[model samples]
Target chain A: MDNYNYASFPLDMDDAVFGAFRTQAPAAGDPAPDGPVTDLATGQRAPLSALWRSGPAVIEFGSYT
Target chain B: MEDLAARLGPRGFAFAFLYVREAHPGELAGHHATFAGKCDLARRLRDRWQIARPILVDDLDGPLHAAYGMLPNMTYIVGQGGRVLYRAMWTDAASIEWACDYLQREAQERRTSKRVAPFYSELRGFRAHDQYARIFMNGLLEGGGRRAADEFVAATEATEGRAAADRLRAARQELPEARP
Candidate 1:
């Protein structure tokens, strides 16, 4: 079987340009990226950084199905 | 994660779920080929799981998921200044609890010292919850039977390798029969 690159084909992480996997996440002291995300319930767009402005945030990424 | 969020959320810790692409797509709720379809699935997910925290959905193509290692379940703890304090490949309650404790203590110390803390990384063991595991296996069986299981196993094996797929199969075998 071929090496299935989920990061590229089905879902492009823009790894070649952004190097997302190099660090896996923002550094301890570095600022987190304010990426665009839509509120699932409300269908509104907002930067993720805005959510954690008040304090620390615990983010869990997953799906139901 | 929800339980921890409830416990720490009162203490100024924001907990949110980022809804990404489907892990085990089947005939019932298969993969989303469009953004609207993905959003609909997200709604169904929120209803099914009774997810209380704010849920942010990624784009249909999954830019966020890919940026976050494309894992089915990944947890990240971001501290003050929006810095990533911890990242777990798989969601482990014990490790997250430890992280919460560490962050709370650090926040307290920062009140007086105003010092920055270093990053902490550890290889914590993964503990699968029995009930949820059963639900997942049963869901696979109900969704499409052996074919669903096979597709799930294949997907897991592709991303996490054969060991993880084997573990899933073992768990599925232990599931009790469904009532008529």
Candidate 2:
């Protein structure tokens, strides 16, 4: 697998660049094991699906990035 | 540096070291880099650097850090009105010096504008030097999970002006709307 160079992409256009680069972004119907989700502030239990949201959030998508 | 903060003064700036979850707990307490025992290593680091600023420990459960959304290691510079002026993860001699310079410039601008400030007294040099270790290392606040809701309230008031206070009161007085 070819490594993507996200650093070279401009901040404003990075999302678009990623979409084209990845070619196949996750769809709504994927049945992969749910990712572990924790409320960063409280370290409390949260829905795994809650990770996908529209808002400002610090995402640490390690290795898969 | 002590010299920098002194030149910066009480009006100029204030520094708070929020001790959150330790990356290397063992390294902090002189055991080893591996995570192990809990000890106040911030004091030792501050003393070595001759820092005169107040360093507070985060709550054992890290509620304070959670409130700020702070990650493992970061330094935040909050302005006079409690507005976060700058934030950086980790600190080094050169990085801190540049930050100090930026903060000093900000202080000068605020002074010129004559803005309302949360005033604090000038910390004495003799006291800072003598008890630097104790002040920097020991827990400043008894407990960490204090509500910074007041800070948010102040910010809202500042942005929307005095008239918004009436709206805020009404909202708090009213009940939540029932879902259909």
Clash pairs, model 2 backbone: none
Where does candidate 2 stray beyond 4 Å?
Answer: A1-65, B1-3, B27-51, B92-96, B103-180
Residue B105, candidate 1: Cα error in Å is 0.7
Question: Worst lDDT window (10 residues) for model 2 chain B?
Answer: B139-148
> Which candidate leads in lDDT?
1
A-chain TM-score of every model: 0.54, 0.30
DockQ each: 0.38, 0.01
Per-residue lDDT of candidate 2, residues A1-65 (tens digit) = 12121112122232332233223322112222233333322435443323223211112111100
Clashing pairs in 1: none
TM-score of each: 0.77, 0.35
Model 2: lDDT of residue B28: 17
All candidates' lDDT scores?
Answer: 0.71, 0.35
Give the CA lDDT, 0 to 100, for residue B65 in model 2: 49
Give per-candidate clash totals: 0, 0
Q: Estimate, for each residue in A1-65, the C-alpha lDDT of model 1 and write its tens digit.
A: 12221222222223342345436555445556558899977889998887778888888988765
Q: Could you tell me the TM-score of candidate 1?
A: 0.77
